[model samples]
Target: MHTIEIQKEPVELYKILKFEGMTSTGGEAKLLIGDGQVTVNGETETRRRRKMMNGDVIGFRGDQFHLQLSTHTETI
Candidate 1:
């Protein structure tokens, strides 16, 4: 399993897919999701803008990922 850290809560599904390189573009992510190629928590997720938070598991194309919130402090 892989972990993807996000700075915020409630990220859109397609954005994560695109950001994680699961899809080449946001449009591709949308299509993939719409085609039922993605799963959330072991169930098929067809909502492209589905809200995803920490602890959510996403599976696609034989790869699984766990969503986590970045806890590292950032220095300006």
Candidate 2:
């Protein structure tokens, strides 16, 4: 399991995948999501643009990630 911290409340699923280096490119992230290779909270998620938030657990390629809001407290 790994942790990914996002500064914003809601992030697009594909962006998270790409940001976390789970996929080499944005296109690959989209393809992986569209192919049902991603899961959220243990359920398969196929929406490429699904909104992801804090506490959301994402699973892909046998790896799990727990999303956390960055504690920087700076207004974006």
Candidate 3:
């Protein structure tokens, strides 16, 4: 299982797919998601803009990923 650290909460499904290099482009990511080729927490997710947060698992192309929220600290 691969771990991905996200800087914030509520990341879009397509964005994650694209940003993570799962898809070449955002459009491709959206297409794959719209075609029901993606899963969230082992369940099929077709929402292109599905809001994902920490602890969400994404499955695609037989690859699984675990999302983790990065602890951002403010510097004085």
Which has the greatest lDDT?
3
TM-score of 2: 0.93
- Taking every candidate in turn, the Cα RMSD to the unseen true structure, in Å, is 0.9, 1.7, 1.1
Instruction: Give the candidate order by descending lDDT.
Output: 3, 1, 2
Candidate 1 least-lDDT 10 residues:
15-24
lDDT (Cα, tens digit) per residue for candidate 2, span 1-76: 8999999979999999998888899999999999999999999999999999999999999999999999886556
Tens digits of lDDT, candidate 1, 6-46? 98989999999998888899999999999999999999999
Residue 65, model 2: lDDT of: 97
For model 2, where is the 10-residue window of minimal lDDT?
A: 67-76
The true-versus-predicted C-alpha distance at residue 17 of model 2, in Å, is 0.7
Q: lDDT per residue, candidate 3, 36-74, as tens digits?
A: 999999999999999999999999999899999998877
Cα error, candidate 3, residue 34 (Å): 0.5
In model 2, the Cα lDDT at residue 20 comes to 84
Better of 1 and 2 by TM-score: 1
